[model samples]
Target: MWSLWGLLLCEALLPIVVISVQVLSKVGDTVLLVAECPPGFQVREAIWRSLWPSEELLATLFRGSLETLYHSRFLGRVQLHSNLSLELGPLKTGDSGNFSVLMVDTGGQTWTQTLNLKVYGAVPKPMVQVFTAATEEAQPPNTCQIFLSCWAPNMSDITYSWRREGTINVDVELHSLFSNGQVLSVSLGLGDKDVAYTCIASNPVSWDMATVIPWESCHHESASGKASYKDVLLVVIPISLFLILAGLFGAWHHGPCSGTNYLSVPDDF
Candidate 1:
């Protein structure tokens, strides 16, 4: 009998624990927070309130009628579904906080749940700029040093990562190019082609990416090709000048048999 009394006393003083749920949302997006209760707990009334930024009662739903009353800043932007879930929409950064739903069953048992909302703005598109590092005349043969810097302007709390789609060979390891935080330093060969690199900017809510091909922007011409072009210009210029001079000489002196002029100046007179 003493054991039974002690067990009853322990049950009477048991503390209620509210379950916490985490939620992520982007700005200008709608989110639904469902009020979860026990399966057999017939809820007679449920009250939803904001617990952060300031404590305020947002809405209440009764059993018989499906009516809901909104409060404060959530007047037109909050709605209730048939399942006692709250639909909050077009969320702003200020809407990030804790919300609680209290459900009272018909037998007077109360269940509370807290939803932690984290609202973040979508990540902006990253811009990548490539810079060529100047090298001395005594530098390594066929080596081109470059730096690719990735950034998103006017953004805070953003993460940056990189993705390389092509290969780089400088007699060095591939991981050596990634030591400079958001700036990737790569030593590529002059003949390297199709080397594309992408920069990824991300937040908890969204991500954006930008790609750049450094090889294509730094184009090269072969020494043999340049020499051949110079040789062609040298052979063509003199020939062109000679043809122009011959045309002028032919216009100035005409053959005697061509007979467009008569030089019989008064000889018969």
Candidate 2:
């Protein structure tokens, strides 16, 4: 009779030990699961496993899957195995979320565990680039309308302004400001002949500037009939005199009449 009682006690304790072991072994995201087993029989086949959420939500928001999010194969559909650990890469504001793991055992058991990953970091500084016409080429004349442009990578929304170093009137019209910090076109009407112009571009985070010197009008007066006659006389007279003097000097230096010896005159004719 005592042996029968001992056997009953052992049987009750065995189920409790098995349940405790199974619960302790479960370490990852807990999944709620249902186990189908024989009635009145202790079942050890049913176990809790970790669940990995489908990357659909992450893909919808960030346009990438979990593998791309973590930058490693650490957070997707991990089987229940020993030493199960997840390594997430550099986290961003988009990475913060409540993630769950769903598990299903062979005995029709299902369970889930939720994990809230909090990610924090700074956003990278925007790449800035200033653009304008090459300096080697002749720019448009200042008298006519001229355009100056500035650009930045990944930025479209920008503001543009024109400034001069010296006193000069500048007529400007802002054409377009993009959403990503870029200046499309800026027109300037400059009347002054010798004026320096500067185009400045600014955004919420940074700013850039470009300087340009437009082609100027020639200051020389136009040639007229009277002016042409005067110019010809002024140049031709000096050149003609110089050539005459040079010819005379050469003849005197090398001619028979040259030197101190005089021509012999006949004593008797």
Off-target runs (Cα >4 Å) in candidate 1 are 1-15, 66-68, 136-139, 167-181, 216-269
- The digit string of per-residue lDDT tens for model 2 on 34-122 reads 22222443322222222233342211001111222322223453222221223333333344444433322234233333455543332
Model 2 regions lying over 4 Å from their true place: 1-143, 168-191, 216-269
- Per-residue accuracy of model 1 over 1-269 as CA lDDT, tens digit each: 35223323433454444789999999899999988886798877767778898887677666455544645667778887778899898898789999988766666576788999998888889999887766669778777677888888877778777777765453323534453347887766765666788888888889999999876544432444568889999999998787776665555554444776633322222
Per-candidate local distance difference test: 0.73, 0.38
**lDDT, candidate 1, at 116:** 96
Winning candidate number (lDDT):
1
Cα displacement (Å) at residue 267, model 2:
91
Let me know the TM-score candidate 1 reaches against the reference structure: 0.68
